[model samples]
Target: MPATGEKVAALGHRYAILLSTFIGLLLISNIVAVKLISAGPLIVDGGVFLFPLVYIVGDVLAEVYGWKASRRAIITGFLLSALASLTIWVVQLSPAAPGWENQDAFEAVLGFVPRIVLASLTAFFVGQLVNAWVLVRLRERTSGRFLRTRLIGSTLIGQLVDTVVFCTIAFYGEISGWDFIGYVALGYAIKCLAEVVLLPVTTRVIARVRAAEAAAIL
Candidate 1:
């Protein structure tokens, strides 16, 4: 184990990167969430599809850095997202310009439902932590041989939890029950496929980062 100061310093470096990625993911996911499209039989929402990269980045952090580091990143993302939501709510309540006829439109776009925010925070927190834990444990178990299995498999399970919980809570009254299930399943599959397709790139980046870290240690 590293000495206390060394461990703190190491964590600071790790969190700097992790936190940056976390905030980026949170902001992008929420900003683009409104765009919904159809991809064959699937309904692809911008946030649902793109948000998996957050888990991918989390996986990379956990696999290389360890679970503790990953958890900090996950929690940091959650807190930041909450902060963003709160700020948006506050702004929406503030007075608009006298000539601003678009206040309603602005509220329609930016105002978040309480249920939706709660579901998002809860699901992301649980799913990401679960993903990181599963990835790290599987890596340890397999001696790091089945990289794809760990990455994709953990993502599959994690995204399922995220999709189901978030969709159920966010759209419970807005959508039919069947439609809710369909959206959740569609989102989960899209996210899993995305992570699988990005596996090669992820592997390469992880390797480079690990090498750099090792070199710095040396």
Candidate 2:
């Protein structure tokens, strides 16, 4: 039989994979957020598709690994995002080769404004922490039953914070007041709908991860 320490180490290894996925989604979402996409009458930033996955992953972490682990992952993502933004800013400022003419394009894609970056990091930190914290509390209240309730409940609140904070900070002065309200309302609704739609998949992933962790101890 494996020692207690070994069992704990194995669990950490499994959690590390989830943590990596969470961070990858965050970094990619930030980069892609530069573009605004329209679907029918709804318009949203390009990150709309990818950013919600971070919260889904966070839900999994909280459900399977618990709040402490989720908190660590959230903080790590925050730091890494800051580092990524700083690195991109540095690269954007560096002089390009004499013949290189794509600097403008590159900046357009990756050159995040300082204000936007600040807004993203702040919103992400608050949103993810809220997700993890609320899920954990719900888990305790429900004694781990009704997975959908916790998932949807936490996501609703978390995404609301995320949408409001991010849009207000990033576009408050740039867009019209009505547009800002629309962005917040639309973004929150879309993100919550995504959680509801993906609930089955999220439940399966959580089950599989919990099973794997259980098997690791045996």
Best by lDDT: 2
Q: Could you give candidate 2's per-residue lDDT for residues 121-159 as a string of tens digits?
A: 999999999989999999999999989988999998898
Give all candidates' CA lDDT scores. 0.80, 0.90
Off by over 4 Å in 1: 1-15, 38-42, 173-177
Alpha-carbon runs more than 4 Å astray in model 2: 1-6
- Per residue, candidate 1 scores C-alpha lDDT tens digits across 1-218 of 43466655664685587669866987789777867777786666678656877877887788878889888888888888889889988989999989888879978888867887898888898889888888888988999888877888888888888888888888888888787777677777778888888999888878876776665454
Q: What is the lDDT for 21 in model 1?
A: 80
Clashes of each: 0, 0
Clashing pairs in 1: none
The stretch of ten residues in a row with the least summed lDDT in candidate 1 is 1-10
Cα distance off (Å), candidate 2, residue 116: 1.1
Candidate 2: TM-score?
0.93
Worst 10 residues of 2 by lDDT: 175-184
